[model samples]
Target: MSMTVNPASVVDEGEFTVRRTIRIDAPLEKVWAAVTQPELISRWFGITRFTGASGAARVGALGTITWPEREPVPVRVEAVDAPHRVSYRWCNPCLGEPVPTEIDEAHSTVFTFTLEPVTDGTQLTVVETGFETTSDPAADLESHRGGWDGELDKLVALLESGS
Candidate 1:
């Protein structure tokens, strides 16, 4: 005998917004610490160092970003409902040409991570949205997709290693 439960019948539509879920073998608090702390930023984000005085586990905190490819970009704290949600916009000079003053679509694009409590540990979902591209978009998402995946893996490794 065979029976099937249609996935749509059971899953919440909002839960389906996530395209990826990474399970790390760490508690929710531990995971949140790594994601929010400025001093610990480089351990996962590939940044050389992070500087944000108010960003040390606080809402409405901002950070200065530094990657190998370009200069440090300013990131304002959009929202920081911590141990569960952290939302912020990130734009590098490398993301594209600076948006014209009247058309600043380039700035609002963001990386938002939502964490949910789970049985073993935590389920971290990182969503990079506002990519709304008009052309030559294949490489951008391709780059970001793998980049986020790898970063997630690194985050898991860092947390699991008890660092």
Candidate 2:
């Protein structure tokens, strides 16, 4: 079944945040696993690996997401609500610089995935905040706006492909 792909929008009400809501032709459980599990996430987004405390996504779990031709970026699980919601904080501004050993809250952003059940499938929404902390707020916001658009579209295609 074909699904509608939604583009991400930037909300700049004092603080900068990127939000996107998309409907996927998949179950909530499946969507949740894709967003929460490192193996599944790596398939569509980046090569994700969680470290510290079982290498699973939970509050305070540490991890890194490596993309092609880019350094491994440090990430931390800030919150998780089972198959419903999960938020991660990462050092996005430090991309070109040496990969930080830890997340610098002062210069990081948090991206949260929220999943909900729909009549035919699941509705997944991602909201990335804290861009004000980055070195260049406008650049970071615009970059992430495009980033989510591409990334989430891949996610929708992955889940809807029934692979």
Candidate 3:
């Protein structure tokens, strides 16, 4: 049987945030690499290109995420804690408009991934915030809510398959 994981999202204080937790049957380091590394990221998420000095998801790093037929979504790394956590601010480009090369706070959101070691593997929680600043907060939140549901499941499958 397939696993079932549900994410929670809320709109409060003018900001929209969605939080999802998944228990991956993989080691913490492996899961961390899958999320932060560009090569591994392409397997489940979009094609990620980090334009930072180290090409790792470090603070101040600028990058773009391009899907099959979509514009390259711009992103800037905001925080990092090695195998534990990483955060970035990116525009909600899933709305189908031209992807901005730079992020504007009023139109961007922050996505944070936090990991914890569990008995079986790792418990990964992703929290995306800062939607209130966007022009279409509710629509953006809804778009990402659906996006994460599929993307996170792909991540889980990727790790579980040992790819």
The lDDT leader among the candidates is 2
Model 2 segments beyond 4 Å from truth?
A: 52-56, 94-98
The digit string of per-residue lDDT tens for model 1 on 1-85 reads 1121111111123322224577777799888888877666678885633344644545445456666665566565567886799
Location of the lowest summed lDDT over 10 successive residues in candidate 1: 2-11
Model 2, 51: alpha-carbon shift in Å?
Answer: 1.3
Clashes of 2: 0
Q: Write the per-residue lDDT of candidate 3 for residues 32-87, one digit (tens) a residue.
A: 99988888888999999888445457788888888887888888889999989999
lDDT (Cα) of model 1 = 0.60
TM-score order, best first, reads 2, 3, 1
lDDT assessment of candidate 3: 0.81
Query: Candidate 1 or 2, higher TM-score?
Result: 2
Best by TM-score: 2
Taken over the whole model, the C-alpha lDDT of each candidate is 0.60, 0.85, 0.81
For candidate 3, the TM-score is 0.89
Q: What are the per-residue Cα lDDT tens digits for candidate 2 across 64-137? A: 99999888889999999998999999996534656676799788999999999999899888999998888878
RMSD of 3: 2.1
> Candidate 1 vs candidate 3: which has greater lDDT?
3
